[model samples]
Each structure stands twice: as structure tokens, then as C-alpha cells.
Target: MTAADFAGTKTALALASSDVTMREAFVETVTAAMDTDPRIAVVTADISAGNFAEARSRHPERVVNVGIREQAMIGVAGGMALTGLRPVAHSYAPFLIERPFEQIKLDLGHQDVGAVLVSIGASYDDPVWGRTHQAPGDVALIDTLPGWTIHVPGHQDEVRALLSTALAGDDRVYLRLSTRRNSRAHSVEGFTAVRTGSKGVVVAVGPMLDSVLAATSTVDVTVLYAATVRPFDHAGLRAAVGSNANVVLVEPYLRGTSAHKVATALADVPHRLLALGVGREEEVRAYGTAEQHDVVHGLDTAGLHHSITHFLG
Candidate 1:
């Protein structure tokens, strides 16, 4: 008898893997969260038809298309939270976080209501759209908001995990997302050792962890993937570094990300923390596809390998 065919089973697994895009994963997560809680709603800027177009069309009644008013969208989302409704808003990183920051800080966060702010297509997803749209520093501003929980999922798996966790959370969450599929942070229910660097470590957040994980085999290195940025897991971090650990933080956001905060918390270790990210002055030339941007920021695997070798060697 001929060997039983396994092509059909393999194909279904392959298709299942391919069908889960980051945006779709987020939409499904949000939809389920909203379904479990009727008070949940979504708001979007004019970009609803662009980045969130599919989700908007998919969940029309639950999503509020706030048009081009970035600030207004955030303000209204904060208002919704007052009535005990969970409002999640999506927009370009810079516009959503920067334009409506006051509302986030004073309205939703200060008032202690559950409001979710999602910023998509961050850190150089599109070059044609140019400088104004690509936001590497988007998460930093929200990171400044004292009660805000900021999450940057560096891999597809982490994107789904973080989104689900955040949607189920009761506090204010700022989710900065990258549309590029390749770097999805490997999602674990909590945190795990993605890679290990012998001489030192790259404690990373967002999708930059992907390149770090890949680069580790080339060089002797270790990477602790920080899927949840705000309200850090200090216990996990302590366990990651048993005694002596020299580290660097890799994040897609600006220098002041959770990586920075985590590094600061490790002052007693006498370890060096190298911050790998883009800042304001450097934002001008920081425009391109995800790969192009990561390469520019020294964020790709080659760059991660080089950084590991340069620092350790």
C-alpha cells in the first residue's frame, strides 16, 4: 500500500499559521473581550479605513469611527470609560499617543478607568507615507503617563498574547503595534528566555526581540523577552539575572521605554545597559519598511550580533 499522505494535514497547519496576521489577531482578541463585556467599544481616527479598515468593517456597531480627529478620538474614549465602559482606540502611533496625551493622562488614567489605546503601524512600517507617520518614539509618551501600562509585542505570538491580556486587563493600556509580520515576538503566557548570550544579555521588548533571538546563535548571547512593558515583572527579571548579568535593552520605541525603566531598576547589579532605539532628532531619516527601519536603527539580527560582539568582546 502507498504511504498515507500527510501533505493535506501539513497544508492545513501551514495555512493556519499564515492566516493569523497581527491585525487580525488583535481584532479577534478585542472582539472576544468586547463580547464578554458589553460595555466595551472601539474608536478610530480617519485611519479606520486604512490600518483598522478590516476590523472596522468587521465590527461596525462596536467600533466608533472618529474620523481624522486624533485628539478627539482619545478624548471620547476617555469619556466612555467614565460610564464604566471599556473603550479601545486605534490610530497611527505618533498621532494617537502624542495628539491626545492630555486626555490619556488626565481623563482616563487619572480618573482610573479602563481605557485601551492602540497605536498601529509603528516604527517604519511604510516608507511612502514618510516621516510624520512612522513613530519610533510613540510608546515613550504613553510610557510617561504614570498609570499607563504600555506593551510592545515584538513577535506575532506575543502580539496575540499581549493583546488578549491587555484587553482582559482593567487598567489603562497603551499598545504600540508594528504591522510588519516577520518580527512578531514569540508569545508565551508570561515571560521566558528567548535566547541566551554567554558574556551578556539583551533584555528586549517589542519585536526587536525577534532579531535578538536570531542573532544569539551567531554570537554567545541571551535575551529575556519583555512582552509586558509597564508594571514590570521584577520577580521575573530577578530570576533572569541570577547574580552577575551585563545587559542592554532592545526596544522599537525611543530610549525611555520599559527597557530603560527595567535597566534603571537593576542599578545594584553594576551592569551596563545599552539602549537600542530611535530618538526625536534621529526621527527625520527614520522612514522606511520594517526591515529598512530596523537596519537603520541597528535593530536587525546582523546589528544585534554586532552589538553583542562589540560590547562583550
Candidate 2:
């Protein structure tokens, strides 16, 4: 347990109660940074009060509320960033990325302006909000850009780590912070192997960590929680799975984004291969909520367990 290369000011963050949220952890970190650096700004695409109450209370003026217009809010945040202000643009995942694809890609990413994009209640909590709101393909779509750094906190701790790193770095970062209770992970300070085994490698992204652990234990396999997706932990995974003939990737994103990318990376390599992800081709219609969909799509406990077991055996 050596010190992280850059843990920010909250080294004691992991020592907290169980009710913490990655969204909260991330906000707290940003709030702290803002306390020191007046140039740090927080922007909201209409839902600032609900998603970032803590942040707004502290920096009321810093929170540039645009009242539901996500695209315009992002443009403002980008403008702020280019003007030497570190801005965090907060909004719902679906609207933030999908609704403003052109703005984010062109105005923010292509401009090379670094703004931290935080999407709250990210993947599947809105069972009642229906498909349009429940699952946002933010991580999958944004990560496609060349330099965007993607962060999906499995738990509060990992959220803190990634947020801390993103705050200190100059790269554009997108975090899909889950708004669901069950979607929280315990948090690992740095992106390190949660566990490793010899049979094969299981790379779990986001809150699918439990499924990964279950599959590995059931099959006596090795697994890695890729807390960060953009960079893809290429070196760490390669070292861990070095000469193995089997590797599996599990993610909450649509198949095209997460697992598929991993499978393609190892496409030419020698190994048994499998990728488990939500199918993007299907029209999203709020079948039941993200959790229910995970179960249906086999991203949940039963599904992940099944996918890993069948793949390994």
C-alpha cells in the first residue's frame, strides 16, 4: 500500500461511512479544490440544484445554472475552461452526452478545452424515468474520442481517486457516477488489480464488480476491476494475463464500447476470448430500470456469473 502517485488532498477519504456516494465524493473533492483555487468553476445543465447541491451552496456564483439546456451549458463550461477556469459541467448522462454530442465533441473535445463532465444517477437507477433517462451511453460514446479520460467509480473510494486525478490533470474527463444504491463499489484508491488468478483475466468495469468477483470465485479465475476505461489499463492487464489463453471483459456500457474494445485489443493474441456488455443496437425503452435490464441482459449477478462460468468452462 504505497502512496498513490497523486492522491490529491484527501488521502484520508477512504476512511468513511458506508453511505457515501461517488457523486458525493467527487463533489467534495472538487469543492475542496475550489476552496483553494478561485479559478475552479462548477456548471450545471439545469439540474445543478438536485445533482450538485453541496457544490452550489459553497460556490453559488461558480455554479452557472443553465436550466435544462445541456448543450448550451456545456458550451459555457468549455468557454470557462478555455479562459483558464477549471469547470465541472454536471447534468444527466443521457442529455449531457447524447443531446450535446456535437457540442461536446466539437466545442469541448476538439477544441482541446479541458472540462470535467460529471453525469449523476448515471446508469440504470431511473426505473421510473423510463429508458431515455435510466441508462445513459455517456461512457461508451465519450470514450471514443481520442483524448477524453473516462472514469466510472465502482464505489466512493475509487470515485474519489479518479476525481482527484482528473482535477490535477489537464485531460478532458467524463465520469458516469451511478445514481443507484446498489451501483456503489467500495472504492480502490488507485487502479490496481483487485485480484488475479491464473486461468484467465476478467476485466470488470463500473459497478459490475460483484459479478466479476462471483464469476472468478465460482470458476477459480483471475479478475481486474478497470476503474478507469479510457486508458484501458493496457500495461497492467497485459502483465497480469501474460501468456494466458483466456480473457473476458465485462462492462455496463453497450457492447460496442467497453467489452468489444477489449476483445478487439486481444483479437490477434492467443487466448480464449469473451466480452459481456449491454447491446446498443436495441432500442432503449425502459424495460424495467438499469438493474432489471442488467439482469435481463446478463450483466447482473446471475448473468455475470453465467457468462464467466460458461466462458471459462
- Please, what is the whole-model Cα lDDT of each candidate in the order they appear? 0.70, 0.73
Badly placed stretches (over 4 Å) of model 1 are 1-14, 49-61, 181-185, 188-190, 279-281, 286-288
Q: What lDDT is reached at residue 181 by model 2?
A: 34
- Number of backbone collisions per candidate, in order? 13, 8
Candidate 1 lDDT, 206-239, residue by residue in tens: 6666667777777666678776777776666666
Candidate 1 TM-score versus the reference? 0.86
Off-target runs (Cα >4 Å) in candidate 2 are 1-16, 50-58, 180-191, 259-268, 284-289
What TM-score, over all chains together, does every model reach? 0.86, 0.86
Please give the lDDT score at residue 270 for candidate 2.
Answer: 70
Candidate 2: residue 183 lDDT (0-100):
44
Question: Model 2, 64-92: lDDT tens per residue?
Answer: 78887888988998898888888888777
